[model samples]
Target: MAKNKHSGKIVQNSRLLVGLVLLVLSIPYSAEARQKPNILWINCDDLGKELSSYGNQQVHTPVIDRLAREGQVFTNAYANAPVCSSSRSSQILGLYPTRLPILNHRNMSPVALPDSVPTIMQLFREAGYFCSNGAAGDLAKPGKEDYNFVAEDLFDGTDWRQRQEGQPFFAQVQIHEPHRTFVHDELHPIDPAEISLPALYPDHPLIRADWARYLESVQRADRWVGEILDRLEEDGELESTIVILYGDHGRPHLRDKQWLYEGGLAVPLIIRYPNSLNAGKVDHRLISLVDISASTLGLAGLPIPIDWDGKDIIGGAKNSYIYGFRQRCGDAVDDIRSISDGEYKLIWNRMPEQPYMQLSSYKKLQYPAYTLYRDLDQKGELSAPFSAFMATTKPDYELYHLKVDPYEIENLADNPAYQGELLRLKEQLERQLQAVETYPQEESEALIQQAKSSSRKYYQEAMQRRNLGPDPTDAEILDYWNHELLLNQKPKTKK
Candidate 1:
């Protein structure tokens, strides 16, 4: 009986030893599972720093304000380009748009990234994470990726939910609000009287109404943000995902969309992570949207490509000044470059002989604000600040002390007192352009002409079908010039 009892005790000890070994083996597996965090990147179109959290009292953005409260808000974040396609192209490829073929907005032939240049999504997919653009319902059309890019193979699907269980994900959700054709929201209407007009714009009823519509669109965008956050919380993935929300560029106002002013280049950026890195803090560091791709790669524990121009803003060295580039926007042709160190801004307009406000059919026909400015200019009722827009010619160089003149009304480039600062910025701009191997605007225009030929044929056909009159005004002449130069065809119809 004694021998039997001793044997039973030995058996119990062996079972306990086996259980202990299994637990030790599972520890590494569990740690590995938790190492890879999900990434959620959200981007909005034509949105500037209009959020209430950014001190815009006219617009109510509760959802975004809540995000700022929970995440890190960047005060001086800027887009590399003021327009959409170019800015977004620079963002995804981690390189300046000037370095790529798609340096302008709405290129007739979309430029594809070289195979050697891997996107952040591609990097994440190779690292064993499921990647997607957004939910399947978010697709605007069947089999059409919303943004520019011919590389559709990078994303696994439209929805991250389709990913395998226990798999991490990298998803981009693009919200198309506050762009053009501002739709009024009855539920959350904005009061035009409350909006503070900028010094550059005349305070007319029409201008006020337009500004109100923009604010309303902002509120509408906020609601969409709330929906996305709610969906994440419901899925129980809020605690495991890192969220980033920002705009593609500045607002769509004149001199704001295609120009290099703060209204055109600056954007709001908010980031949140489960690790709470600088959570609920406002970072005043100068950051560029180009840095987003590399910063994301760093956060995911992946290596950034050496050839990429972007740097990790969160973990890497901060930039002294952010740079901006402007090429052709729609029918307008321009070559403007700028650099700002968060206090002073320097702009170099290569074509100073050209007018600041070019003839753009899209801008003229679509926006009532443009018509109002034209009428006011003709009547000679526009104030000095407002009259600058209608100037016949622009200065070759413009320098503004942004600290004192936030609206950029004064040009201090000619002032002898600012000569030292101007020289410093000019040298920096030259170095940056050389480093990126940026081509002259003429080279870009030549490529644009080649692509515009096809589009010109289509537009000419449409004009003939509509029985439109001859090109008389500057706007019409410019459009016709673009068409004629590309297609080498005269108009069949007459006035």
Candidate 2:
């Protein structure tokens, strides 16, 4: 009887041991089951809310429109900066460009992101998500992430398919479209006559033609979107992946690409997830691109860093205003800061003595409409709205009631009726500047000198490459500058 009891005890001990082994074996699978969803971020360059979904009849973006129909569309999404480098820097680092050394677009000497500020991808990587930055073509060139401190460390590769099985991923795919030098597509030709001119733009044949070309580029961008979606579906990751589609900044036009106006600051933001949270909804809350970093980390179930300047837009409190910063862009050196509360927009031109239209070689070469407008202004043929771009010097402060003046035509800074609103916004701007730790605008004489030196060097290099003589005529120099600008297809180059 004692032997039988001992055997029974041994059998019970063996059963317990087996149960413990089974639990240990199932641990990894359980963790995998609780893993965060994959993220697919698609960023387009030089695009705004020109989609049919945005109530614009001019451009047909069927793929993006369908995404909007099945996703959440942000009606008031603004880029932190008007141009690419500054905006991209802010988006990646979750900090304002003004606070970083990359305050200007295409900074001559690219500023590295501080070691303390980890990129969104880096956060994902630390959270066990495989991160990849497959942004190529004009969008992933050298200067694109030159402002990023350790850009290479942020991503594993340009592709994420090679990631470990059952592992989540964070992928960024950047597309270049609707930018200048619009590629003419015969199959998707837009009618110049049908193109509607904005109030600020002249209704000329050349301007219409340019608009039509831009529409065609938008169509091309739509096709690229379809291709990316198809790839995601092919991988069987479409439903489970959190997809985000947005533009880096507004359209690439005069007073649009580098200016602080709506044409430059406003962008389209659409997000889709399988959980159906706010799906097919339109969020009118003011959102800045900088908010994306924290929001993305929140989506991945990761802890947002305390030093980030942006709030988690997905779950955090709503923002009352979105801010914009503009410093030196290409060869132009200026200081402009703006704040918008979705209804009113105020611009503080720190360098009020500087002309609104600074002589930027890149702008002069790329925008033919700029040349046309300048010629028209010279001839005294420009009207009120069109003539605004030709102002010798901008006002110290400019205020616009977006509801009444959607195009931001009239400035109400000095008006007695709007003084209260202006002062309120001004105070808000001050508070924002302080919160972001932005310093007062300093003179950029050094930056201007650097830009001129770089421009001369680039010209000389191009001429030498072409085997042209060293002595170039005045006309020849101008032609060379234009040609060099065209050859450098990337928007906002850091020379």
Best by TM-score: 2
Over 323-426, each residue of candidate 1 has an lDDT whose tens digit, in order, gives 99887776677788999998999999988877877666556644556656776677788778878888988899999999999989999999999999999999
Q: Where in model 1 is the C-alpha error above 4 Å? A: 1-34, 135-149, 275-277, 438-495
lDDT of 2 by residue, 102-131 (tens): 676666554444444557776666555777
TM-score between candidate 1 and the true structure: 0.83
lDDT of each: 0.75, 0.75
Cα TM-score of candidate 2: 0.85
Off by over 4 Å in 2: 1-30, 136-151, 275-277, 438-446, 456-495
Window of ten residues with lowest summed lDDT in model 1: 1-10
Cα deviation in Å at residue 387, candidate 2? 1.4
Clashes of each: 0, 1
Which residue pairs clash within candidate 1?
Answer: none
